[model samples]
Structure formats: structure tokens, C-alpha cells
Target: MGFLTKNKFTLYGVAAILLWSCLVALLRDVSELFSPIGGAAAMYTVSAVFLILVMGLPKLKGFSKRYLVIGTLLFVFYEVCLALSIGMANNRHQAMEMAVINYLWPTLTILLTIIVGRKKVSLWVYPSMFVAFLGVAWCIAGDAGISVNTLANNFADNPATYLMALAAAFIWAIYCVVTQKLSNGKNAITLFFTVTAVSLWIQFAISNEAALTFSINSSITLLLAGVVVGSGYALWNQAIIGGNLMLLGTLSYFTPVFSTVISALYLSVSLSVSFYQGVVLVTLGSLVCYFVTRDKPQKYNVKVTT
Candidate 1:
């Protein structure tokens, strides 16, 4: 209670993290119910409505032109890539794999911070990155274990989904870095999400997907997903703008584990032993990255102009 009273933004960040952990599973289900682009369109449409009802319209005044233009573009693109990557997976099981890939953002975020912020880091950075990438490869390798052949084959089989998921990882990393630097205490999350919804709808309109036939359960899932997605972003925008990014990054280290567990259970799927092994490696890599730079001072300046 006392901590919450003092550090409410941090709590919001934690809440956002928890909500986002459920994202992969919900997205898979939603995509199963509606087609990929159509379901994503519907979910973000509900997200836009949910945010408007709760957060009111976005105020665009007083934002840095850089933040406005770059932040909006990055946020919108990241959200689209995130939705499409998982939603387009070949199967529910593959969707779970995509969750692992998307979580590469945590490590990438730290890595980008170290490089872009020009912060000094330990030699561990190299090994940490290797372990992280290796984890992804190993995860896709499944029972075959990590190998160049298996890893390449895995991606070859689903080039579009895998490429989108990988792009989402890097895009999100850049977004986290850029948004924190230029937010100026203002969050255009409502605007960004609204744009994302529109973008998704446009994609859906052009695609042949019929939005599938929604059952009662799927409809309920979509509503719940919309609520989670909307509130999660609203809270996350607050969090990244105010809370400790390093601490949040540290906490995010566990996202893949949480996501895999939730996704497997929610989707009623099984994962191979290697997949779990890869998850651990990926998490440990980020943990190591966190350790290397935990004591470094925040280089980027933040303000609450709003």
C-alpha cells in the first residue's frame, strides 16, 4: 500500500506487463475466431473504443515534433507488427513460438539503450546477445536441438510470420528507447492506438479473410482482449514516461516464461523440451544485459510538459 502510494507509476507499469503477458494467447484465440487481419482489426477497434471511453481523446498540443512524428509512427508500426506476427502464425503452437520471438524486445531494448545512449557496458553484452539469439534458434529447433539447418528450416517454413515477429521485436525496442527520450510527459497512446485500429481495418478490408464466424466464447474473448490491450497501453504509456525503465526491463525478463506458460495453457498446446530450454536462455541473456548496465545512470532526459 505504501509503495503503491509512493510509486503508482511503477505499479501501473507492472500491471501493464502482466496484461501484456496474456497478449499472445488472446491474440491467437482472436485470430482463430476471426481471420488474422480481420480479427486484429476487430480487437484494435474495440481497443480504440475502450480507450476513448476511459482516457478521453488524445491531446496533441505541446508535443515535440520529433516525438509526435517518430513516436506515433513507431508505436503504430510496432502494434501492427505485433498483431500480425502472432495472428498470422501457422498454428496455435506456432503462435506460442512467436510469443518467444516477440519477447526478444526486452534484450534488444537494453542493447539498443547501451548503443544508442552510448552508455558504457560490460563485456558480458556480447555473450548475452549471443545467448539470446541462440535461445530463439534453439526454441525453433525444437526436439532437433539448436542447429543451423533446423533453425534456418524453421524460419524458411514460415518466412512471413517469422520475419514479421522478428521485425516487431526490433521495432518495439526502438520505440521503447525513443519514446522514453522524447515523451515530454505526454502520451499519445490513444492517438497511436486509434491509428493502429484504422491501419488494421484497412488491412482487413483489402484481405480476403472473412473474420471467421465468431462464437459466444470468441466474442467474449475479443471484448476481454480489447479491454486488456487498451488499458495495458494506457498504463504502459504512463509507465515508460515516468517509471524506472531499467526496473521495468528487469521485470520484463520473465515475460517469455509467463507468456509461454499462459499460451500453452490457454491454447491447450504442448511444447517441446528444447523450447523451454530456449526460453530460459533468452531470459538469462536479458538478465545478464540488465546486470551489465543496472548501475549506469539514465542518460536520456525526460520531462512532464503536459
Candidate 2:
């Protein structure tokens, strides 16, 4: 059973990474039809429709009002911020510069858990956090070459992209914390639908500037995005449930690695020397967090019964 679970989670991690890569690649294509806002709107709109059809109105209506409202609003903001980040970065190099910045979240999440959940951090936690922090600093310094230029050249420039990425990370952290608190044994499917619907409405409201014309490519990409979100979340939930989160988080570093590769292949993105350096820091630092942090749940006994 243990071996089977491990193998399954290993596959889940790989699948999650791949799906994210595809989603990122698709975003580049979709960005052409509408601004990041429009693309996000389209994505959630499609997701909403998909959920209504598959899950039906009655089941979707069964969710708690709190879940319906908070989950949707949080994720909507996350998507919008994410799109803005991508728009600002524009290129893989620039986008990744901002992206590596967000590697801070996993490390910071421990401290956040400490503060919000009032969980005590183990002694080993600090060392890992420090290592991860230094790693993030290294990544920032290495990528500072591009970030500085972008910031200096245009204030309205891709600074928003980096800011958006940071915002997304922060919002995601909050969402994680809140979801754990609120979603005890809740129906993930219903929660997903509510979030999608609410987020779509938000996106549509904000995306007045978006082009309405749906090209064949954009439509195809939109469909792919919906499928990826729907399927990928299911698989990722399984992974977290079955595998050790510490180990899985360590493995999940491969997401950006896969993103870089996919960008290179499809988007014609070239890797910079500094980018590779950032990769090393992100990979190694995440591993440090995994190893140094206690993996066993007995220490804290966080009763996230959902």
C-alpha cells in the first residue's frame, strides 16, 4: 500500500507539473485574444459552464454560502494577478524572473502557519527557512539584472508582472490557509464550481477592454485550460492526500523547471545563465525545506478535518 501510494503521488507530481506547463503555454496563446484579464475571464467562464453541465445546478447549489463567496473571490483575484504578472513579464525570461521571486511562499508558509494557525515551528524549521530565504535572495540577486532594467525603463512596465506574481503567491497562501479552515470534508467539485463562477463574473466585469472575437486557436486554448484546471486539481488533491506533503513540495519544484522547458520549446524562450542559477536555488532550497521541516503530522496535529 505504501509503495502504491508513493508511486501514485510521484505520477501526480509529474502530471501537475506537466499540466501547469501546458497551461502556461496556453496562456501565451490566449493572451493574444484578450488581455490577461480577458483570458482569465474566458477560462473561468468556460470552467463555470463545464461545471454546471457536469455537476448540474442542484449539486452546485448545495455548497455553503461562505465557500461559494470566499473561494470564488480569492481565486478570481489570484487569476487576475497572475495574468497581470504574465503580461508584465511578457517573455519567459522576464516572467521567470518574477516567478522565481515567488519561491518564497513555501518557506514563508511555515511562518504563516505559525502565526495564523498558532502552530509552533520546530527548531529545524528555522534553519530550513533561512536556507530557503538565502536561496530566494540568491535567485533575486541573480535575476536582478533584468528586473532593474525593466523597472527603470518604464514605471508602467512589467513591474506589475512581478508584483502580480508576488500578489498571486500571497493570495494563494491565504486561500490555502482559509480553505483548510473552511473546507472540512466539503465537496471539492462544488467548491471548484463556485470559485470558477464567481471568478468568471469578476473577470468579465474587469475585462471591458478585451476583444470579443474568438479565434479558433483561442477557443482551443480556452478548452484546454478548462480541462487542465478541472483534471489537474483532482490529481493534485490525490497527491497531497496520498503522499507526504514535505516530499511532494520538494518534488513540486519541478513545476518551474518544466515551465522553463515548455516555454523554450513552444514559446521560443531561451534560458539565461542567471535563470539556471535561479533554478538551482529554487530546487535546492525547496529540498532543504522538505528535509529540515518535520514531515510527520504528529508533531503539530493540525486538525484540518476538512
Candidate 3:
């Protein structure tokens, strides 16, 4: 009991991972009920409403409208790309592929920190990132029967899907770097509300389907995704504040692995050997990057907002 109390940060970190892992599977279910845009709209709307009820109206006195608007736009971009990456996929396997590909954001964030912020990183970080991306290539190639031609064909056929996934990664990397200069705490709540409102309107304008669909599974999943996953951000923030940032960052590499496993179990999807190989290489590369950076004097401390 005493030990558990002492290591609460570890628990928070684990909870964050569990909550984040469930997001992909939950979103996949929600996507079945709504279009990609519609699903994002519903999730963010629910999340915003739930947050408002819990936190009351966000205090906006000190925050400038420009900053708030920029923050909101960033959130919108991230969510849309994220939704398209998953919702646009034809199946759970493809969704996991996009999801793992989106996981590249963390590494992108690192690189951006080095370039944009002029932060110095260890030399080994570059090779580690290379190895990690090789894992992604292996997974994708493996999915196409390890044939280069098939891999090229797959990308050519589903250019939008692959592009959206990559865009999600790039957008998130920018968001992490940009948000650091903006607000945290209550301001984050405000950003959530703004994103929710804007996304709902955009969804309505673009989607032909009616707003809101009631189903047992989808409703439950929305609750988990909107409330549970939404709240998990706070848990993650706590973990980041209390725990070793490098360790937490390293552990986050497991999110794609967990997402893949959860999706496979829940959706009864079969994972290919290449998928496993990719997961191993990606996870290994991320760990290597973290370890190499761990001893550096100036570490990239960008917060994971989603």
C-alpha cells in the first residue's frame, strides 16, 4: 500500500497508456456509426460537453482571442487528420496501419524540436529514428506480401488514406511545438470547446447523415472515447508532471502496439507477421531514440496533448 502510494505516477502513466490504447478501437467502432467527419464531430462534441459539465465554462479572461483561435485551429487539424486516418480505412487492419503510421508524430516532434527550436540532440537519435522508420516500412511491405511492387500499388491505390495518416503525424508534431508557446490548464479546456463547436459545424455542412445516432455499442464507445479518453489527457499531464519524462515518452511507443492488439481482439482481425515485425522495429527504434537522448543536457520536453 505504501509502495503503491509512493509510485502513483507510474500508475498514472499506465492508466494513460490504457486509455490511449482504447481510443483507436473505440474510434473504429464509432466510425462504423458515422462518417469520418461525423465521427470526429460526435466525439469532440461529447467530449466538450462532458468537460464543460465537469470544469464549468473555461476562464478566458487572460487569453487573447488570437491565441485561442490558433490553438483551436491546431486542435481541429489534428482531429480531422486523426479521424480520416482511421475512418477512411476500409478495415481494422488498415486502420491499425494508419494508426501506427500516425505514431510517427513523436519522432517528428523530436526532429522539429531540433530544427525549429534549435535544440541539440544526440547524434545517435538520427540512426534510431531511421531504424524506427525501417520498421514502419517493413510492416507496410509485409502487409503487401513483402513485394515492393505491391507496396507501391497499395500506396498508389489508397493515396488519400496514407496521406491523411502522414498528415496527422505532421500536424501533431506542429501542434506539440506550437502549443508549448500557448496555454495549458484552463486554456486547454477552452481549446477543446472551440474545436468541438467548429468541428460539429464543419461536419454538419459536409455530411449528409443526420446528427446523432443512438446505439448501445457506439454510445458506450463514445463515452469511453469522449469522457474516458478525454480525461486521460489530464492523467497523462499528471504523469508528465510527476514522472520521468523520458521514461514516459519511451513507454508511449507501446501505444501503437496496444492499439493494434486491442483492435485485433475486439474486431477479431488477424495481424500479419510483418505487422508484428514492424511493431517490434518501431518500438525498438523509439526506445533507442529515448535512451540516446536521456543523457543529453537539453531534452525535448514537448507535451503530448492527445
Candidate 4:
């Protein structure tokens, strides 16, 4: 109990990292099986149920209006952008491409943190970020590598899905940084999950999405994805509030690599060497950004603030 209590926050962060690594594959599976918008709605519903059972409903009485409103909006919007980007993909290969695009948050978050802290960043930081963006181009271009024709053609093929993924990366970076400020030592993740679930259902209803059909595989994927989605958020909330943010933030960039491995096998997308190169660049650049501010611990001082 003593050791567990002392390191619980760090453990939570680690667990969230591992669970989220599986999310891209699971998210793609559930989206394909359940029908994009409807599938996302169902996945969130299952996540809400899982959270309610695990943590019960969050107490709303003390949550600040700013945190309650803004936090909910950012989280829900980010979730929608992420889910829809994958769901709207013209194909599973595009879904994997979108996942790579979403992994840019680690660099974005670290950059935002350095700015928020008003600290002097290493000169290499900007170049690292540039390299990371280049990686998105590389990953998107596949074996074509990074070039005007290939990059433009690839992204143009599915402009909306690519755009949404780009938006998701930015939105999540803001959420990771701002959530600490607004949370007031309170974790509203449970409440946010509930709201996201409800909002998605509404979107699913109003849309022209096909009717959802039941499948044993779909049901099983939904259950697993729900647990991953629910527990990942809950644990991430705890980690941000009290865990080692620097470590977790650095580790977060691994999403692309893990997403590549998991989504490739799960979705049966045979990737090229160039795609793996992009994953490396994305992860490497983000990791460099994290170290750029290593001299300033408070730059990553992401603990809950009132």
C-alpha cells in the first residue's frame, strides 16, 4: 500500500500510455464494424458505462464553470475530430495515415508548454518541430516519400479526413496544456466522457449513417475499445494531476510507432519502409523537443493548478 500509494500517479500515467497505444487499432476496428459516426457513438457509450462503473459519476458541485464548460468542449471536440478522422477515412489505409497525423500532439504539447512557461528553448526546437511535420508528409506519401506531387496528391485524395486529423492534433495539444490550469485539482474526465457520449449519439442520429447491425466481433471490439478509451482517459487525468508529466509527455509520441504496429496487423495494412521512416521522424522530433526544455523542469510543470 505504501509503495503503491506513493507511485500511483506514475503508474496511472504508464497504464494510460500503454492503453492508448492500442487505441488506434481498436478505434479503427470499432469504427469499421459499427459504422463510423454510429460506431463512435457506441464506443463512447460503452466508455461512459465503464467509467460510471469504475469511478462512479463525478461530483459536479465544485467544478468551476470555466473547467466544466471549456474543458468539456475541448475534450469532446478533440474526441470527435479523432474519431471522425478515422471513421471518415476512405479506406483503412487512410485511417492509419490519419492516426500518424494525430500523433503530432506530443510535439505540439511540448512546444505549447515551453511557450506557456515563458522559458528560453533550445535553438533546435523549431527545427525538430519542422522535422516532425515533414514526417507527416513522409508518412502520408508512403513509398512515394516526401514530394510535392505525392504529398499533395495523397492529402488531396481525402482532404476532409486529413484536415480533421490535423485539427485533432492541435486541439489535443491545447487540451493537455490547458486542462491542468482549469481542472482545479478536480478530474472532470468522467463527466467529459458522459457528455461526449451523449453529443456523439446526437450527431449519429442526425446524420445519414447507415443503421447499425450487431455482430459478435463488433460487440467484442466495442467492449475492449470502451475499456481502453475509458480507462485511458481516467488514468491520463490522474497522471496529469499528479504524475511525472515530463516522462509521460515524452512517452506519448510513441503512439505513432505503436499505432503503426497495431493498426497494420489488425487492419492488415502492409506498410512501406518510408512509412516506418516517417514514424521514426515523428517520434524522434518529438523526443528532441522534450529534451530541449529538460533544463527547465517547470516548463513541464503540468500538475493540477487551481
Candidate 5:
């Protein structure tokens, strides 16, 4: 955390934000063409393949067996839930609920840290939690033009969409907790590949109806989303190795911002003032929680290279 307080760390963080924004923008466009399940299946399958190719070489050392096993299991749940949520969403607007809900991970991680690791949390943590929840309430109340009537119709017709979002949020929270405990320098890269591979198999097993079709454009997006973004997640571990937790956490608030922007620009989804306000409040509240807390070094001993 101390290392991350420097000028260089801020620059790298800005670069990460830009990279993530571009990735979300691309996903917003390609999602229209491919079936969510199909695109997700393709994305993770390609991700697994990419991980194997990158990590299978003899020069790279492998992860600890125990850490690899646990990481793979948690990641399996996370990816499956995420893909299902994306698949279930009718459009980008509905799909974004996943992002909004998933950001709860930071708060969840803090709570889980207290519960599982018996860590002492700062005083501001609980208030931050309430602020985050208030953001959710605001979003739910806002006039994004989505309605309870529409949601009811969707629930009656396709319970999968909403159910998937809930499942994704829960699983991702679990993944964050597990990562916080097990992540360390040498094992990080190996665990990244193992998790991606395991998640691919889990998704495959759940969705047995497999037919393959590809277009030049869709295929490229699949690669970028799966390979690039999936690997980008691994890179994120590197980012945190010496980066400011407060700044890092705050910058991640940009994911939803990017999601909202791409949805508006490319997907032609209108941005409601209420929705933006809700997002802004949620993001600001999270920042307040992060910056106001007393400084602590990352508890886990993690190191990364490339």
C-alpha cells in the first residue's frame, strides 16, 4: 500500500482504467450478435486455451497444489455465474445490473475478511456498507425506464435473467474472499490459469447443448473479452502487488462507469439522470470508505512479474 502511494502507481492505474474501459466498450457491441451463453462459452473456452498455451511451458513454475485446487473451485463458480448472468440479460441495460450488483464485492470482501480471517475492520466500514446499499436502492428506484411490471413479466417468462444476476453476485463475492486469503506472489500466475480452465469446464458441464458458429467480428470480440479481459484480471493481481488499495479500489469504480458509457454510446441505451446519480453516489461512498480508513498493508504476501 505504501509503494502504491507514489506517482508511478497512479499512472499504471490510469492505464488499467483505460484498458478496462476499452474492453467493456467492445463487449457492449459484440454481446448483441452472440448468444450470451454461446459467447460466454466461447470466451471462457478460448480463455482456457490461452491460459494453457501461456502457462504450459516448462520455464514457468506451477502453483502450489492446495492453492491451485481451491482457486480453481472458487473461480469455477464465479465464471459460471457471470456467464449465466450475461446470457440471461435481455439487453445491455438489464445486463448492467450484474456490474452494479457485483461491485458489492469490495464491501463483501471486507465483511468476509472480518468473519473468515478475524481481521479488525476500520470504523468507517459499516457506514460504507450502508452507503453502497443505498446506491442499490437508488438504482432500483430510479427511472431507467425498466419497471416492476417488466421485471415481473421477465420473471414469469424467463426467471433466468434475474436469478442469474443474483447468482453471479453471490459467486463473485465468494471468489473475492477466496482470492484475498490464498493469493501470494509466486502462486498468482499459476492460479490464474487453473481457475480459468476450471471455470470453462464448469460452464461446459452446465450447458451441454453445444454448437459452434463463428463470424470474423464475433470471434475477435470473443477472443478479446475472454483472452484479453480474462488475462487482464490476472494483470490486475500484478497491479495490486505494489499499488494503493484506496486508489486501486476507487479506480475500479470506473468499471460501472465504463459499462454505463458503452451501453449508452454503442448499445444506444439511454442514460437516466437517476441512474447516473445513483452510480455517482455509490462510487463516492465507496471512495469515502476507502480513503478514510487507517492504512494497512495488504495482509497476503503476493508478488508478481509480467
Candidate 6:
């Protein structure tokens, strides 16, 4: 019990991963009942309402409007792209494929920090990034039945799906960079409200379908998604701030693993051998990149500011 309390951050990180792992399956289910935009809009709306209840009104005094706008836009972009990537998939397996590809954001975040943020990194980190890309490629190839030609054809045919996944990665990387720079501690809830409003408006503009249908299961799933987004993020923020950053970063590599496994089990999707191989490779490569490049006693100093 003493050890558990001391290592609570580890538990928090794992709990966050579990919540996030449920996303692919839950979103896929919700997408069956609602349009992509509608699902995302509903989820964000619920999350916003939940946060409002928990955090009260945001204290926005002296907050930078520019930061608020930028943060809201970045979050909105990520949510839309993520929704489309999963919602547009033909099956849970395809959604998992998209997720594996989108999981590259963590690696991209590291590279961006070194390249654009001008942080110095070890030479070994570059090769580790390459290995992570190979893992993604392997995952894609496995999804294509281990045929290079089929892989090419798949990309050629469903370019938008793959592109959206890649875009999610890049956009998230940029968002992390921007968030690090802006680090506004007090306006997180306000920014979340802004993002939720924008997402809802976008859904209304694009989707002609009803925001929700009258189904108990769908309502439960949507509410669960909202809880995950709202509470999961709050827990993650606490972990990042209070926990050992290096250890937390290392554990984060398990997110995609958890996501893939939960998605496969919940969706009853068969996993190919190569998929397992790819997962191992990606997980290993991410750990290598993190451990090699990670500074000791790493601190985000962002303060849960959205």
C-alpha cells in the first residue's frame, strides 16, 4: 500500500491508457449510430459539460485570447481528424490500422521538439524514430495481408483514411509543441468550452443527421466516451504534473498496445501475426526514443492548461 501510494502516478497513467483504449471500440460503435461529426460533437459536448460541473467556470482573467484561440483550434482539429480516422473505417480492424498509424504522434512530438523546438537530442534517437516508422509500416503491411502490392492499392484506394491518420499525427505533434510554448495555466476550462462549441457548430454545419438517436446503448456509450475524455484527461494531467515524467513517458508507449488489444477483443477483430510483430516493434522503438532522449526529472510545467 505504501508502494502503491508512492507510485500512484503509474496507476494513473495506466488508468488513462485503459480509458483511451476503449475509445476506438466505443467510437466505432457510436459511429454506427451517428455520423462522424455528430459523434465527435456529442462526445465533446458531454465532456465540456462534465468539466464545467467539476471545474466550475474558468477563471479567464488576464488570459491571452490568442492562446485560447490557438489551443481551441488545435484541439478541435485533433478531435475531428481522430473521429474521421476511426469513424470512416470499414471495420474495427481498419480502425485499428488507422489508430496504429496515428499513434506515431508521440514519435513526431519528440522529433519536432528536437528539430523545430531546437532541443538537442542524442544521435541514437533518430534511428529509434526510423524504427518506429518501420513499425507503423509493418502494421500497415500486415493490415494489407502482408502483400506490398495490396498495401499500395489500399493506400491508393483509401487515401483519405490513411492521410487523415497521418494528419492527426502531424497535427497532434504541432499541438503539443504549441501547447508547450503557450503554457497558459488558468484558462484550460474556458479553452475546452471554446473547443466544444466549435466542434458542435462544425458538426451541425456538416452533418444532417440527428446528434443522437434514442437508443439506451448508444447513450451509454456516448456518456462513457464523455467520461473518458473529461475524467481521463484530468487524471492524465495529474499524473504528468505529479509523477515521474520519464517513467510516465515510458509507460505511455503502452497506450497503442492497450488500444489495439482492447479494440481487437471488444470488436472481435482477428489479429494477424505481423500485427503483433509491429506492435512489439513500435512499443520497443518508442521506449528507446523516450529513454534515450528523455531528460532526467522531466517536467511539463504546463499546469493542465488545456
Number of the top lDDT candidate: 4
The reply for model 4, stretches above 4 Å from the true place, is: 1-9, 114-118, 237-246, 294-306
Local accuracy by lDDT, each model = 0.81, 0.59, 0.73, 0.82, 0.57, 0.73
True-vs-predicted CA distance for residue 134, candidate 1, Å: 1.0
Residue 87 in candidate 3, Cα distance off native in Å: 0.9
Q: Any runs in candidate 5 off by more than 4 Å, and if so which?
A: 1-13, 21-31, 51-62, 117-123, 144-158, 187-210, 241-246, 292-294, 297-306
* Candidate 5 local Cα displacement, residue 261, angstroms: 2.1
Candidate 4's residue-wise lDDT over 240-263, tens digit each? 767777777666657678768877
Best by TM-score: 4
- Would you list the clashing residue pairs of candidate 1? none
lDDT of 3 by residue, 1-306 (tens): 997877788678878787778777777777777667677677777777776765567667767676677777877777777777788787777888888788787777777867886767789889889978887777777756656797787788678888988888888888777776766433565356556657666766876766666788777777767887666665665676566666666677777777778878977888888898897877777777766655452444635533
Clashing pairs in 2: 85-161, 184-306, 185-306
Candidate 1 Cα deviation (angstroms), residue 283: 0.9
Expressed as tens digits, the lDDT of each residue in 103-146 for candidate 5 is 55555555665678676767787888788766755655566445
lDDT of 2 by residue, 1-306 (tens): 887755887577557657765556556556655656666667756656665565555354556677656866766676666655764466655655555555556655556666886755567777766665555445445545545554455335556676777777777667666766666645455455456556655656765664567878778878887767655555565555555554455556556566666766876767667666666666566556545554465332121100
* TM-score of candidate 2 against the unseen true structure: 0.76
Provide the lDDT at 210 for model 1: 72
| Candidate 6: residue pairs that collide | none
Question: How many clashes show up in model 6?
Answer: 0
Report lDDT (Cα) of residue 281, candidate 1. Answer: 93
Per-residue lDDT of candidate 1, residues 119-178 (tens digit):
677899889988998898888888987678888888888899998888888988888878
Candidate 2 positional error at 293, Å: 2.7
Better of 1 and 2 by lDDT: 1
Model 2: lDDT of residue 15: 74
